[model samples]
Target: MTDQPLPGAYWRLWFAAAISNLGDGVFVIALSLLATRITDSPLSIGLIATFATIPWMLFALPVGVIIDRVDRRKVLVIADLSRGVLVGGLAVVAAFWDVQIWMLWLLAFGLGVGEVFFDNGAQTILPAIVPRDQLERANGYFSAAEVTTNTFLGMPLGGALIAFAVWLPFGVDAASFVVAALLAASLRGSFRPTNSVPSTGMIDDMRGGLRWLLGHRLLRTLALVVTVMNLAFATTQATFVLFAQQELHISDNAFGPLLAVIGAGSLLGGIIGGKVVGLFGRRASMLTAALTPVFTSTAIALWPVTWFVIAMITVQAFATTVGSILSVSLRQQIVPGQLFGRVNSIYRWFSTGAMPLGALLGGVLATAFGLRAPYFAAAALLLIASLLVATGLTNAALSAALTQYSPVTTEPTFATDVDTEDHDTDDTPVSIDRDPLDDLLAGP
Candidate 1:
């Protein structure tokens, strides 16, 4: 299974996501730049970022349930097409008249809603396309394409496009989404979940997904570690601009290129992720991911030098990307197909839910203890998170969780599902086992 080439459809999916992310890269920078034209106030910018993220906190669970019930491909197509129209409309308006701050906020929220659906659908559809043995490779490829487009190429292109015209970047984003929708449509097979049943009410379904994830020892522990790490990372991100200016004395112009180091590192990570995971195994790979940020953050706190920050964050980005590839592949392996969307969404909600709080904390801590304070605080938090990962994500725990946990199995309705059935081939009922953590917590 590992030696076989991925299917043609998988390549198509990969290209589509990559193209879409390229536009996303441009949009991320351009959107904030456009908002600055409206007003340079940090509050206005914060509002834009806030609204864009609000949908994730608000809609992730419901959208997850929706992904499970509907044809997942349709969700992806609809999400892209809708976003295409929305951004296209923004381009038209911006070209004709002055863009209002409120209008930008509205567009951001709309785009966020679309992302909530597209991302979950995209993730949920993968196991259907690739064999379980190949998930790491598949995810690594997807991650590489994404980081290459969105960050490496997208950010700079976005800045240049904005310089060309206020409306140009939005128009480009619109075109990309339209193209992505077409690519999604070209995928030849059905993407409905194998184990999905008729709807049992959204709330009940959502609750079921949440309960399952919370009860699972591996998933639960992973989510906690990610949440804390994300908090630390986001805090650093939120304060970085100020920290760079005040502490490192990085001029405005050099900031973007310096930040690009993160993208470069992620690109390198994505390319190497499968091999690293293979060589080191999941526990050590995950531990490496959790610990690298500690060193990077501590360096920033201690030195506040521009070149040092760039180098350290580059390493940090690589480590984080490796962690992400492995963790996502692990979840995709174990979670039930019918429940993947809901459970995955719930897991992410917990994992990234700290972002807004961290953003706020970064600002407050920066003001209270100075720009470097956030960095120190982040390093301390990440150190705590690293220790948790070191202790919790052992090879034994991962092995036990993989063997003990089971996804709901159903008869295949689609051709591809039948072919891939052997990969998900078990219909064996797995009884509940005592959580591995209980034994660990009992101190042997």
Candidate 2:
């Protein structure tokens, strides 16, 4: 069946996401550089990331319940507006004063809190805007926009602005957030999930979401694997700036461009992700995604050359993007829409929640051993993740999940005037072979 064009509301969401991500790209580079100015300690620098991500661990579950209860659009707008105000305040403070490390840590924590709400709301709202079959393609557009704007455009811009003044990038980031909030607010729709069960108290709602995810073997296993994968990635990421500066001898001016180069691969991955999944089945693509990081991390650790490290990171980003697209699309296809916010939150709680610990671990490892140590540790962790994907997330298992939840018709009802009726033209189910989860559950 020919694919229907994405709706206007989807485009608005896309623009909001792109603009905000652009700001994030700039904010990331600026924040890292600002933290470095305050303190050169690897542990101290890593703590910035730890502070930013700690909210995911503390607030994700309860926030998930809130997402299900509220209008996701309002949640997104409020989150963006709040971030804008907070960042704007930080920028004003940075312009006048010599910002301390503790101040940066506090700002990072505030931004992280906003992210916990904005990101989860955005994901939950997508299945409502776009059809089930078009999810991969729709997600591809979002991923591409995020990478292109955030890294390709915003990152280099951030580095340049930071060279001029530390406050500049933060100002730009704040403006972007405000603008994104405006665009998000313009999206005319009631984005509340229409089919959610009546709240049986917040704790019970949270538990129901948790139980649904845990009971599903594939999603459960995938969530655990991602938890470890995020840990490995964060471990390397926490001290990457130090590695670039101390080892590769990259100047702050050049650091953003180098990240932009690595982001080129992510851009490519987002552009072609849907096609790649179509070409290679989910199993092969996921396994490839799992294994690519192992080699890349090992190579970077061993070589430590500027060009070589960039090349390795670029390749890893491509594979990782494809894997991420597949995983999100799979979840949207199978999970009930009413439970999407909660389930997705639980999944992120397991995966993203590990980042703070990993960031701390990276700092400790880099401080005690060397900058190279985190890369080696990442390689080992990724190897284990690869094996888990190879053994547990087989093609048969993925197919079974899809078969059980075919023609994914349980989506949040949007009150928009734009006609989305054409998006789901093909509702025919594919033939199911067997219950793949049953075999896995009954394993020897």
Give the Å error, residue 266, model 2: 0.4
lDDT of each: 0.72, 0.79
Model 1 CA deviation exceeding 4 Å by range? 1-3, 36-44, 239-256, 367-369, 406-444
Candidate 2, residue 107: lDDT: 83
Candidate 2 overall lDDT versus native: 0.79
Compared with the true structure, what per-residue lDDT tens digits does model 2 show for residues 171-239? 998898788777667655576666666887999999999999999989998998888888888888887
- Candidate 1, residues 1-444, lDDT tens digits: the string is 275776655665676667777887777767756765676444454455556656778899999999888777788788888988999999999899999999987887788788778778777766665677778888888778877777778767877888888899889988888887776666555667555678769999999999999999888889888888877876666545556656787654454555566577888888888888888898898888888888888887888777777788788888988888888888888887778889999987776556656666766777767777777888888898889888888889999987775442422244343344343432211100111001000000
Per-prediction TM-score: 0.87, 0.93
Candidate 2 wrong stretches, greater than 4 Å: 1-4, 421-444
